[model samples]
Target: MLVALDGVPVGSQDGTQLGTLIPVTHLRLPPASRMEFIVTGPSENVKSAQLITQAIVTGPNGDNDTARTLATLVAREEDDDSNVSRVPNVTGPPWTPRFAGLATAAVNTTRRLYFSENAAQTQFFITVAGQTPTVFSANNPPAVVTTQGSVEDWIIENRAQENHEFHFHQIHFLVRSQDNFAINGSQPVAAIQGQMMDMIEIPYWDGNPNHPYPSVTLRMDFRGPDVGDFVYHCHILNHEDQGMMAIIRVLPQP
Candidate 1:
């Protein structure tokens, strides 16, 4: 179980420090998601505190994430390491982001992908646009292909009834936007926008056909030196084992 600190989020998983710290009491982290936060030590008057996680319901039929205590926090004695550096109360000085120019960088291509599962939830798929959904196989050709140094934008929609985590290997992506979800007042979503991350969660869609499926748009950067085939998939072990994954081939730059 991943423990969430009851404090302020200072940085994201990809090491992009936030311009401003966002205070949160309970941070929800899905599979493969990561966050960095600052937790102040307990006051002298406080004896101990428990680090715990709250229960979460992924879907109507999905497994339950049970709440549990992870550890006990106790204040240190006055004589114990007075030289220990104190955690700053304020957000630190500004710094440039690693992908500072990515927001406005020219997009080389755009693609759409979606997640779907069968009624029995035994089979799963991550399908590219204009293609038939098929179980993932190593023998299968790459579902998507691109050349190195290309910046592409992908829209990933979740058509399943249970939540799905989108994870990419070999590179991180910037989350551009979220659509068709009621997140107008979500502090976590607001705090995470524009950060580079290797994983993100797409909420489950209701069965109603009139309701649009939940989706997230991502800005993928393939400008790094790495080149070759890598797989992107739902981080959930069961889902991944059931074929909710696909390969992307990144050709070497000429």
Candidate 2:
């Protein structure tokens, strides 16, 4: 089903404010799935309008099953719009209460880990100046080791011609910085760095030394129950099959 405001379906909701204007250009919805959106009037003076939900169902043999109107919404104007206006603004500065200590730990225990694809773009490996690149081997030693109660920062660099997604199995990480040739910057506030994600994208590098390589600074958290051996690799399946993956060991802390 599609949610349309002013006869247009918006792709996705990026903001959650009640009265904030959200642009609806174009959107596509798959069958049997539900989607939610915040619909706002195109203009303040346009008091009354229709909200239409349409469902397009397709059959397995490339034939159309049904095209039907799901629901019609009638927007009623209130005598006083003051109630909507009085709602407190919800979007603003980052919430920093729980992030202060984590930020400090990340800064103090920073660890750098570099990743890049082999020149053939078939194998994945981590690079260090003095040592040979550590290529993938199921029985090979763990490329990275950390204590179970530590937080360490990893600088993941992408040297492949195509984009690769970095993923870890047992623990999530915080994106401290996302920088490369395109946008060279950090999160607006330290609080915004609190996002805990298990995967993130590493943009492609053209193999130019002068140009900044696409990299992400991730603060990995091992303070949870995750321990023993786990794998971190390029989420791309073919890349992983071709040797772009490594094992990481998290030792139980004393």
Candidate 3:
């Protein structure tokens, strides 16, 4: 859970400080996702505060994560001379977005990928555009091949009834946009908008032919030095094990 400190959101899960603070009661966190928040202690006569997570219904067939208390906050006396120091107000210079350049960088390729599952939901597939959907296996060849130092925009659509988290190996990607997320009422909080992250949750599709499947557009950065076969998949272990994974081969720059 992304716990808001005093009901305010101040930073991104990727460690980038948000340009503006957004007030939110709580934020949903999928597996492998991270977030940073600043919680201020109560100034007045509040005895204690509890940090808790409400139950989350992942999907029709997904597990219902039970609500739990993460921690309890108790305010110390003002006159107490304990060594614990209070959290000070933020006073540094404004934060600069790490992937600011990617916002305008020309995208070398635009690709469409999608998630699907069998009728019984026993098997899953993450397939590339114009290819047969196949379960992931070590024997399978790289599903995607790209050259080093190239940037691509990937639109990942979730066609399943349950949510899935998209996780890329080796490099982080900027979240360019989320399609049909607001309509599903699961849009990301303002603080994480445009943030660079390795993993993000893709909400489920409602199976309506007229409505588009929920999708997230990411700007993949393959410019990093690492170049080899790496896999990207749904972070959910069960789904990945069933077959929602694929390999991307990044060859050395020409």
Candidate 4:
């Protein structure tokens, strides 16, 4: 059988320019099966699973079914559940403490200016207001120098329209908890059940119409098998590029 892709003749094997035949000994087309040609090629660098997932071929009679299957597969990947979710404006379930904020200031100082002097310059929306990037006090950074296995509380905040994933590049830290404990305290959002990732996913919750905002908190372990300058940013690429990123220097044990 003849096969062409995008109007160009395609050879099954790049090296030998051989085409796979459905009725040939190498490939047999079952009556109801939608998959078409099965091309045999060098398997040096290909993972067995990847080969199956990315396998592709073209053939006659099953064009419509092949297209349908391919479309479903592509859609599933796009909606990968592995990806962290962004909180929606439309509420879901029951949640407390919303943390949504704009990339830039949404309000300004008035006559009272109660919480801060220049509210815009002085304060930042965070999961915890006590952290340095938010409070800017002398004790903002309590762990200037910390040892491995030393318990340091890294409070991550989510002050956006959607949830964000905070990732630690160099070292994988133990996830302590989420949105439960305070920055100054030592407990977790929940019981330390099992081991988790160095990455923390902060969920956003929309507040009431009377007062609307959303945020979540995360506790992280600073100890690591590898330590150096590492990046902390929102897994969402757009937010990181827009300044939702920071750097952390995991100091050696002293």
On lDDT, the candidate that comes out on top is 3
> Mind giving the per-residue lDDT tens digits that candidate 2 earns over 83-143?
5655356657633232234545744365555666655555676553245676678898877
TM-score of each: 0.84, 0.57, 0.82, 0.37
Candidate 4 global CA lDDT score: 0.34
lDDT by residue (22-103, candidate 3, tens digit) is 5556777778777666566676788899989898767675767899999998876676667767766777876654454676
RMSD from true fold, candidate 3: 4.5
- Single out the weakest 10-residue window by summed lDDT for candidate 4: 109-118
> In model 3, how large is the Cα lDDT of residue 50?
94
In the range 1-254, model 4's lDDT, one tens digit per residue, is 32322122223312233333333222212221123344454354543322223322211111122322222211232436667766576666533211111112122211110011122322322222443443323333431333443444454544332344555555433333355223212123231112233444454423223422222222344434545555555554444544444444566776
RMSD of each: 4.8, 11.7, 4.5, 22.8
For model 3, the local distance difference test gives: 0.79
Q: Candidate 1 vs candidate 2: which has greater TM-score?
A: 1
> In TM-score terms, which candidate is top?
1
> What's the C-alpha lDDT at position 44 in model 1?
79
Q: State the lDDT at 67 in candidate 4.
A: 22
